[model samples]
Target: MTGTRFDPSWFEAHHVNLSATERRAATLTTRRTVKKDWQAAWLAQAITCIDLTTLAGDDTPSRVQRLCAKARQPLRDDIMAALGLDALRVGAVCVYPTMVAHAVKALEGSGVPVASVATGFPAGLMPLSLRLAEINYAVDQGASEVDIVITREYALTGQWSKLYDEIAAMREACGPAHMKAILATGDLQTLGNVYKASMVAMQAGSDFIKTSTGKEGLNATLPVSLTMVRALRDFREKSGQIVGFKPAGGIKSAKDAIAWLILMKEELGTRWTRNDLFRFGASSMLGDIERQLEHHVTGRYSAANRHAMA
Candidate 1:
């Protein structure tokens, strides 16, 4: 979804109530307990919304191919059949720009989109021209989605216009490929800054506003996610445009997955729980989820090695 025009005033007066946000986030996991079949259903739903990622310095073509294979069949055949399903696939496979071609070739005919992290991912310290070039390169290499990092310095210094301009340029570079603006909230310093950055990103045409790059000191947290979700809700109310949310970094385990699903359901309704509206930026989290599903099906847990990602 391409976004609307820049509007600064939409979030000018917005400030997060730290304690209040914390209080609400605290209740999401405990508010309602979905056990047995219901819990399995939620976990299965979470599997489809995952952006199965492997962004590392040691990444290789073979590794990416294996990752794509997992994306194609996240759950074992026995588990899928026991759950009474035909197939289960992840939302997308995310990789670095240079790995886009490899992922695309590997995931061919699998109905899975390849997402590449561009615009100097993780740090975004490169020059503007180079960053935009990186995005173009990834798209040219067959990336269906591009995750671009915003210049946190711009937001930290309160230069909203600058942030909008750069992100807009990145969005333009993305062309038809979906753009996910990675705000790296861990470095933004405050929830208020997080809200404004989310507004600016959606205004600049980001299809999704991500919580982090998964490299920050403090990655995704419930309070930060709540702030961004509220901002997206406000933007939707004012502009009538819906943008997706992705909370990445340090989100592992089946319990964490359910907690995020709960957050989306309680705050934005069932629509946000879909892959098109919400995604979990995760890697190891899938293994734990598979283990839990196995337990639900067989009444016994399996070893982590049995559910290897790649």
Candidate 2:
């Protein structure tokens, strides 16, 4: 099928059912990771948060540029503070390049990190060196994590080597920061492409391999997330290597977050801790999750009670 279209079965072949013992082992791992001081230290992490700058990309009179700018600091702070104050493990705060420092500074000491999108993000349309520079600049400015989008065209066309190089370049650029490689899964034709992309991304040194850019038509989905989580699990078993998983884009609400958590429980199981193991990568999701927490904790919800970070 070199010249033919990619088939999802090409990937399904390796994803067989686990044995009873294997399943039990997976459950134990999940309990350990999920049960860790999680209630007091981080409850929202029961569903990781998200990265959202493009929410301003719509055609509203709200002005995308200024909205993006405002969403930069206030959104990050709002997310961090709400999660922080609620005693939920605040997930990382994601931001665009210029505002990463603000996200970094605002999230300081909260155990929440600053995640910056880079490497010709969204479009992945730029020179290799320039992309690397963008990554380095963000990390140097205090981003604890770097999310770099892969050239979807390259991955789709079987240009695995080029894709590998881009991942490696971005990894090097991140220095000590965790590098999350965005597959922009919607652009790919099949699950096989996502599988191949995930393996290649991890092999090329990405600390985490994400499912979508949140800019793609479909963004993240259960099937797509299941594909990546399974890939990461298998890769870990054989290589004794652990790679993180993130399902970004379109994820809003506690139910969506719980569904993703269920997928992680069934697929990757316990190693899915609060940090690099998983994250939501959203803009508005934190607030939604907060409302859920408030309802669960205090049994009341009012628009006036919603806290916004100054």
Candidate 3:
């Protein structure tokens, strides 16, 4: 994945008006509608773009193995046949650094990549050296992708230079593994901050810019997502480079997934909807999507219990 060259001045000069951003975000949901089979198809696409994740303190090897099995075959056999999708699968399986080995072992023959959240994940407060080492460890343990959290203090304090340098080092540690820089937008406080941070991460060579860590008080919201998407558009226009986007946390339903997919298509066009360019960092969301697909095919809503993650 080629990354854009770092340009601190470009990000420092960026500005985002909150009111206009909110207005645009409000209309995203009502702007387009995908109904019936079209909606089902969109949901299937959403499934393929999901980074099926299990980031928990109590996550075990068995749990990681089960999650890998689900990632390999995201949809049940009946649902896949009904949708005429014989080879459906999630984009990747994300787990903690320690769980990366387990996930890799379980998904050995499958093509699904194992993603590990590193760099003091969720709360990137550790020292830079340690964070970088953690990333190396995860990659050595067989992680194809590393989701690293940025130091929110840099964004909060308007330290664009520091933020850019930090992300650049993390990217270097990732080496061959793709890097997703989580901005933890919920803590950034403003849309403008979100936009600037997005630019900094992209400029610093992040393959993807993620919305949240799913451990924050608030996570991926429509308005914040819009701000970040527009930032991606600007980055692509100025540098002629395309980067992926991931809206994590608080997205838990088929309807919510379609909403984000529509946002990507409408804002960045069709190219951003694919797994290579977009992803959902979710755990329980797959279950809801499966339930909706079942309803679409069988015309009967099944209990949530019937669609377990593993």
* TM values, all candidates: 0.99, 0.75, 0.98
What are the lDDT figures for the candidates, one per model?
A: 0.94, 0.66, 0.93
| Candidates in descending lDDT order | 1, 3, 2
Q: Lowest summed-lDDT stretch of 10 residues in model 3?
A: 1-10
Give the candidate order by descending TM-score. Answer: 1, 3, 2
| lDDT tens digits by residue: candidate 3, 1-310 | 5666667777676778889888988898887999989999999999999999988889999999999999999888999898888798899999999999999999998889999999998899999999999999999999999999999999999898899899999999999999999999999998889999999999999999999999999999999999999989999998898999999999999989999999999999999999999999987889999999999999999999999899
Summarize candidate 1's per-residue lDDT along 1-310 as a digit string, tens digits: 6667777778888878999999999998888779999999999999999999999999999999999999999999999989997988898999998999999999999999999999988899999999999999999999999999999999999999999999999999999999999999999999999999999999999999999999999999999999999998998999899999999999999999999999898899999999998999998999999999999999998889999998
TM-score of predicted structure 2: 0.75
**1 versus 3: better TM-score goes to:** 1
Candidate of highest TM-score: 1
Greater TM-score among 2 and 3 belongs to 3
**10 residues in a row with least lDDT, candidate 1:** 1-10
Pairs that collide in candidate 1 are: none
